[model samples]
Target: MRTILQRVQHASVTVEGEISGKINHGILALVGFEPEDTNEDFEWITKKIIQLRIFNDENHVMNLDIQQTEGEILVVSQFTLHAATKKGNRPSYIKASKPDLANEQYEKFLQILENNFKAVQKGIFGADMKVELLNDGPVTIFIDSKNKE
Candidate 1:
């Protein structure tokens, strides 16, 4: 599993000209699943995302998790996160999970977040989505389950 977390003042996803998911003051989570990803990977990443102290506190220190600041989460499935571009100009998604398997994993990942976090909104799987966000602090983070970083 590979994920990118962006602290955002606002974020939204539109599918087919209709807004599907939206959030205010939260993390925009762009998630991807590899073919070999297991439930443990989802759980681990979910826990890390929920616990990450990226938001600032009273003393202006980055010491608060999302919940502490009452932030929401907007998740979008992005298989391209696993794209391999070492060969040529064209990138290959060979490391990404197949659509069916990935959709299942995406659902499981969302379920984990919904259960453990506050407000969680998600984009449709396998849909052409238009996502917009006002990045907060421009603070971005990347996590890869395989690397455990």
Candidate 2:
């Protein structure tokens, strides 16, 4: 499992010119699942995301976790996170899980996130989505559950 986490003031996802999900004062997570991912990876990544201290406190220090601030979350399936371009100009997504497996993991990931956060929004698993976000601090972090060391 891999994720690109972006701290955002607001974010929303649109599919076919229709708004699917939106959030305010939270993180937008583009999650990718690989063939080797398991439930253990899901649990680890979910915990880390919710507890990550990216939000600022009164003293202007980044010391508050999403759960502490009651922040929302917008999650989107992003197999492209695993795209490999080492061989040629075109990227290969061979490391990305098959759609059937990816969809299952994606749904599980959504369930985990929703269970942790006050509000959680999501994009369709395999739909073409347009995401708009006010990236607070433009803060972004990449996490790989497989390389947790």
Candidate 3:
């Protein structure tokens, strides 16, 4: 599992001209899955995301987690995060999980977030989505469950 976490002042996702999910003063998480991903991967990533201290505290230090700030989260499925491009000009998605497995994991991931946090928003899996965000501090973090070390 891989996630690109972007701390944002606000974020929104639109599908077919309709807003699907949105959040304010939170993180926009672009989540991806690999063929070998499991529930353990989901559990680890979810905990890391919510507990990550990217938001600033009163002293202007990045010391507060999302829960401490009472912020929300916007998650979007993005298989391209697993793209393999070492060989040719075109990127290959062979490392990415198939849609069935990816979708299942994606839903489970969202559920885990919802269970832990008060405000968790998500974009539709396998849908064409347009994501908009005002990146707070332009702070972005990349995490991969498989590469814990």
Ranking by lDDT: 1, 3, 2
lDDT of 1 by residue, 116-139 (tens): 996999999999999999998889
lDDT of 3 by residue, 22-116 (tens): 99999999999998888889889989999999999999999999999999999999999999999989999999999999999999888888888
Rate residue 130 of model 2 by lDDT: 99
Q: Which stretches of model 1 miss by more than 4 angstroms?
A: none
Task: Give the runs in model 2 whose Cα sits over 4 Å from its true position.
Answer: none
lDDT of 2 by residue, 48-138 (tens): 8999999999998999999888898999999999999999899999999999999999988777766766588899989999999999998
| TM-score of every prediction relative to native | 0.98, 0.97, 0.98
The per-residue C-alpha lDDT of model 2 at residue 85 equals 94
Predictions: Cα RMSD each: 0.7, 0.9, 0.7
- For model 1, which pairs clash? none
**TM-score of model 3 (CA atoms):** 0.98
Task: Give lDDT per model, in order.
Answer: 0.95, 0.92, 0.94
- Compared with the true structure, the alpha-carbon lDDT of candidate 2 equals 0.92
Q: Candidates 1 and 2: which is better by lDDT?
A: 1
